[model samples]
Target: MQLSFLNLASNNLSGKVPDCWARWPYIVGVNLGNNHFTRILQTSMSSLPLLEMLNLRNNSFSGNLPSFLKNGSSLVSLDLGENQFSGMIPSWVGQSLSNLKILVLRSNKFSGPIPHQICNMSVLQILDLAHNELTGYVPKCVNHLSAMLVINNSLESYIYFPVSGGQLLVEPLLLKERVYDYSSNLGLITSIDFSNNELSGEIPTELTGLKRLHFLNLSNNHFIGQIPQNIGNMESLETMDFSRNHLTGTQIQSFEASSFVGNYDLYGPPLNNSCSSNSSSNKEEVHHVKGINWFFVSMAFGFIVGFWAVVGPLLYSSSWRYAYFQFIDRMWYKLQYRCYW
Candidate 1:
């Protein structure tokens, strides 16, 4: 048969996938999620050399990392989340699937430290291991995932592959009780979720280097120590959760300037609030005081000019002074004659 894509998700289908995968050499995408599919046969992947997307989530598939995936060098997005899979997250995923952009194994029973080898995927953008039994510190080599470092607003986030007649798209995923549209913003999103685990140790400072990461969740763990001091370097963060942990870090994760309210010692690019906001207010206050002083000065000058305009003539002009006194005397004489009559 000539097949390029097979999507049997959310069908309530049960039973193991047939061992006939080797029969389709042109297959590029296979999704068997949200079903009762039990297991991935060990040798079933030798045939689909062109497979790029494999989503086996929300199923009863249980076992160590599938051996067949080690040879899936062309795979780009692998989501085995919400499965019964257990065992150490294998290293071959990084050794072989070097082109992967999305890797999610959340809601599984997998245990053990995240393999440093997984950092080999330079283009990886989304990594979710939440709601698992995994333990161990996050590998410091995470900065090696180069795609999470810089924000590529152009053609990088549109990660899709053109198959024989159509396209294989990645759906959205949920992390920390929230889900994002899987495909539209896939390439533009850089996230990491390791919440609800047994992991401990200081968070690697290297994580601060991912200057464009959008979401981060490390809640419900045994972590201690302050957050990385250089975290100010990550400027593109949006949603961050570090609750329910042993973290003594100021737990400061805000983009608002008010987050630095009492820090008279803080200084840097974005922290220049005192210079921008306060200086503007101070200038306005000084301008208002200057206006009030000028008004009072002008009023006093007007009062002096008016008083002098009337009194100066009476004081300096002899004829005008004599006329003023003669008018007063005539008014007094008329009042006396009226009284006598």
Candidate 2:
């Protein structure tokens, strides 16, 4: 008996992917994604020459690249994202899979320099190698990928296949910060994602020549130097992210703590959102302002004392009031006598 397709994805299937897969010589597509499946030993595996699409993403599969995949010349789409797979990616992947259009190794533990041989895949439309520990330079020959340089209006940007269960299967990839399956006439959607890696060195200037490339993400990496001035040549570019990179070197190092050290009013992280300096100084100023407000008090006290000293006797004593009236009368009589004379 021969099987044409096998898709048991997103089913919570556990344990190892059975070695029985090696027996399916006639199989065309295999999708066992989003499951809890464990390691598949190299000894039990064999090459399936007819295999076109193999998706084993989001699994517990570990160890190096599967040896059987070295002969996957018929493979068009291969996704192995969010797995525990470790070690260096083999160079033969570029030498073998010339027919590959999409290759996704996102969120894996892959380390070491990306094999520059991948620049040979002339027909590759999407290449995702993000969230890994990969280092070294992105090959200057990246623009040699001929598919990214051209635009085809009649082609669909995503990969979709008819499963054995008589249903359509769409391969998922990261596009515009989202993780979803896109199935439509996406209009020459070519992407290059090397984000979340330790990759260093300047971005290749030849990357600007890819006129039809749709999405480009090199975020969270150690990429340095200026962005290519000819980037505007990418006429069909819709989404491009260079955030969290070392493009201009350190993102926050130049801002320095000294620039904000005395910013007592500023509040936030690296500053802990607590203005202790402002709070302490503000409390001391409250007391200082309070103690310095004695001028009004002294004015009122002097006014009360002066008013009583001059007019208290007139109000409180009759004898003193009569003497004050007599003195005024004598001054008035003396003034009239002098005027009459």
Global lDDT scores for all candidate models: 0.80, 0.76
Scored by lDDT, the top model is: 1
> What RMSD does model 1 have?
19.9
Q: Please report how far candidate 1 places residue 39 from its true position, in Å.
A: 2.0
Cα lDDT for residue 80, candidate 1 = 91
- Per-residue lDDT over 107-147 for candidate 2, one digit per residue giving the tens place of the 0 to 100 score: 89999999988989988988999999999989898888888
TM-score of 1: 0.72
Q: Among all windows of ten consecutive residues in candidate 2, which has the lowest summed lDDT?
A: 249-258
lDDT of 1 at 195: 85
lDDT of 1 by residue, 151-231 (tens): 778786567776634454555767568777756456678889998899999879999999988888887887777668888
Error of 1 at 89 (Å): 0.6
Off by over 4 Å in 1: 164-168, 253-341
lDDT of 1: 0.80
Clashing pairs in 2: none
